[model samples]
Target chain A: MDQLYTPSTEKCELVSASKGTVKFLLDYSKSLSIVKAEGMVFENNLN
Target chain B: MEHQTDDSTLVQDYISGDERALEILINRHNQRITSFIYSKVLDRDAAEDIFQDTFIKVIKTLKKGNYSEEGKFLPWVMRIAHNLIIDYFRKNKRMPKFEGGDDFNIFSVIGDEKPNVEKQLIKDQIDSDLSMLIDELPDDQRDVLIMRIYKDMSFKEISECTGVSINTALGRMRYALINLRKIIQKNNIVLTNY
Candidate 1:
């Protein structure tokens, strides 16, 4: 976790350490689960 | 900070009909949680959105008594984040790029303690590329990478959370690195050694 604090140059570094689990969790969920409030359903559904 | 009421306990309480328990956990983790999310997205607005969603999800799911209370709450939160990240990419209709920078930026805050030029340079180089590569990885590989790189969970712990053998976790990491290496190679970029 603390590895992200290292001062490395942009040209020399290979991986991004700032990506902690906290950030990963938040960033991962952006724009998740589209809105289905309008009774949106598949054309093939036999309702 | 006497029993301190760790997150696992709070989560259990929340599941067992105590609504305030979730609030307590959120209050404790919110500040740090925002910064953590910011690192992955690199955009404040987007990070905030995910942060809110993460809690909403916890609330919605907790009320339903979906968690097992196995005492490994952090990993559970992280898994939710992993899924969100995948969803983010899908909605954007853009693939994550490997060389796009940031070679493990999770350590960014810590390295600020000392003034070292070389270290600063390395951190800078890693800024964007590493994140993109992480985003580029397949879900299975990315999930394992999150366990090792972000959460710092041991192989054993990861296996338990993922319900797989230790060997499976190791294999996922192995292949993730291979694919990462391939991505960097194709891009004509070198990471570890100068």
Candidate 2:
């Protein structure tokens, strides 16, 4: 147990550390929206 | 296995007129960063809006040749997300509420008696940084830690949920903390109060 678990002395300040996985999938349409938005940014930057 | 390009190299490539580099970077980090923002906002449209705004800022910064964050691209982008989340809350005049009982409130731990945006934002930035570090943990350990800390579950509850014994649950929690410390040190992440 000692070798497996070394207790951390660092203070825990996280309010809540939930799971990192997104609940909703990014899906194709939403991703395309982002791509479209990026295209607009590139176009504007060029203009 | 195929070789995956590191974020800094991709960022440099994007800066040097390689459009594909930016696409790869965005696609690589899109899920995690979007999940982070969505977790905070809890509104799909708002989260997506902020995500777009974040990349827009990233593009502007890179285009102006002011992108000096070196290899720390994800954290820098997360900071931008953090600021945008704060802005979203300020504009809406509210904060994201934890969905559990009175066991813990994130705002309580991070906020003052009176609402202080600056302190809250700073603490939120630290929390966001910590969240990124937490992502580095093994899935099993991360599941145990999230159940124990975020869900406020007991060892017995965690064991029951994960179909393991209470002792195993406790062991995983312990290992989670130990590994979290190692990851923090390895990444040079500062989790202290500013």
Candidate 3:
């Protein structure tokens, strides 16, 4: 198994550079999840 | 020392009478905000309308000097847009709501019972910067990362489909993250949820 890289403070500093990008991606993913959930519900309703 | 006027100052200026300030603010955030709305709704026209309404509420709220959180302009605006999208879905009867105790309602679809339009628009309106970063990764790394993220596939599944070992798939994902960090350092990409 590939060991997960634990983000240290220095690594976090590197991450901070793209903090906005990361946060946006996360929010986008979350919204997509909700949308998918809605779709599943819609499909279920149809059956 | 040079004076640095933040978004709050710009908002204050707009509230005081400078149209240019508000214009600058809109120009700065419009694309991300619009893209966010589009991701949720998947309908361009509806997204546009919601985007407009979001700003209209922002303007009205600001004009009334109701915005006390000066440094939080973007976050405030994001909340407005999110709420408006929810409102839109609720009004259209597309959002599922449970009613009449014991009635387990999931997603409510009003009007015609048509096939769900879920599979067509799986692209979650990924913002340009993240997309650029993903595009910059090496092919093997990018492939594994996309399968894990956009497809929500497990590493084993990714390996099965890509014909790579599970360990190799996981390694590729880890390397993708490392490479992404390097790219962010080189390009100075700033990521913000708001």
Taking all chains together, each candidate's TM-score versus the true structure is 0.38, 0.40, 0.38
What value does the lDDT take at residue B145 in candidate 3?
Answer: 92
lDDT of 2 at B108: 69
Clash counts per candidate, in order, are 52, 0, 4
- Tens digit per residue, CA lDDT, model 1, B62-149: 6545567775776676667667766876876665433325566645533568648886788777866788887899998999998898
Of the candidates numbered 2 and 3, which has the greater TM-score value?
2
C-alpha local distance difference test of each model: 0.66, 0.72, 0.69
For model 2, what is the error of residue B120's alpha carbon versus the real structure, in angstroms, after optimal superposition? 41
Write down the lDDT that model 3 would get. Answer: 0.69
RMSD of every prediction: 24.1, 25.6, 26.0
Docking class of 2: incorrect
DockQ of each: 0.03, 0.03, 0.02
User: Where in model 3 is the C-alpha error above 4 Å?
Assistant: A1-47, B1-5, B94-194
Residues B28-80 of candidate 2: C-alpha lDDT, one tens digit per residue: 77777777887787666677778877877787677656789555999999999
Per-residue alpha-carbon lDDT of candidate 3 for residues B84-182, written as tens digits (9 for 90 to 100): 999989987864443445564444524446533552233333356788899999999999999999999999899999999999999999999999999
Pairs with steric clashes in candidate 2: none
